[model samples]
Target: MKLWEIAHSRTGDKGNISNLSLIVYNMEDFKEVKEKITAEAVKKHFKDIVKGEVIRYELPQLGAFNFVMYDALGGGVTRSLSLDKHGKSLSSFLLNMEI
Candidate 1:
């Protein structure tokens, strides 16, 4: 199933780092999200876009996972040649990931 079935996400960027937070709608699904969505999995998911490391922070209290992706924005927003490279939209793309 797609990750979005159980969660939603928020995204932001600074320099070449991209931030994405995956938040589950129900706390009950938190365990599965934690198990399936690892930093390695996410890094592979966006291999074409993210050129550096993917770091995941588990927020059990919030039932969310915050990911820090380096070298992800083509050297930041202002420097990226692609118009659709905004971090905000990439969060949606990540929702398409299947667990």
Candidate 2:
């Protein structure tokens, strides 16, 4: 399923980097998410569209997961000119994601 379909997302942009905070619902959901959205999976999905790092965090107490994607805009939070990064928008790209 799409990212939004599986979890809620909060996005912030700083320069060329975009941070995505994902709050998953439960353990089952988290497992499914991890299985489908592996680091390699993200790299392939955003290969040319984003640069930098994609970090994932697990919050067992909150039953949530967070993803911090860095240098997505080619420069990072300090030098990106465009706030919207083309059709490869986070929300849209997320729709194509299985997790």
Candidate 3:
């Protein structure tokens, strides 16, 4: 299962520190999302590309979730680089995932 399949859609930035906001279809699905689509998961999935801690946050008010993946590119804002060697289209890539 891919992150995007279960998540509604993602919105955020790339290159430096990335903030990825995801919308789950239903609240009940939060567990699955948390358990399966995790920081380690992201690291493992895109091992060569992603790095750092994948922190998750829950927004009950909006019935949404957000993942803040730190140092994902490589080092920090200025030095970190992406697998594409350019940056990622996170929303589209996540949307294409199977989960």
How do the residues 2-99 of candidate 1 rate in per-residue lDDT, one tens digit apiece?
99899999899888899999999999999998888999999999999999999999999999999999999998978898786667888988999998
- Leading candidate by TM-score: 1
The predicted structure with the larger lDDT, 2 or 3, is: 2
Q: TM-scores of the models, in the given order? A: 0.96, 0.70, 0.64
Better of 1 and 2 by TM-score: 1
**Candidate 2 RMSD to the real structure:** 3.2
Global lDDT scores for all candidate models: 0.92, 0.65, 0.63
Question: What local lDDT score does residue 92 receive in model 2, on the 0 to 100 scale?
Answer: 54
Order of models, best TM-score first: 1, 2, 3
Q: Please write out the lDDT profile of model 3 over residues 1-99, one tens digit for every residue.
A: 665656675545566566777777777777777666666665566565456777778776676767777665565446744454324466566556555
What overall lDDT, based on C-alpha atoms, would model 3 receive against the true structure?
A: 0.63
What candidate 3 gets wrong by more than 4 Å, as runs, is: 74-88
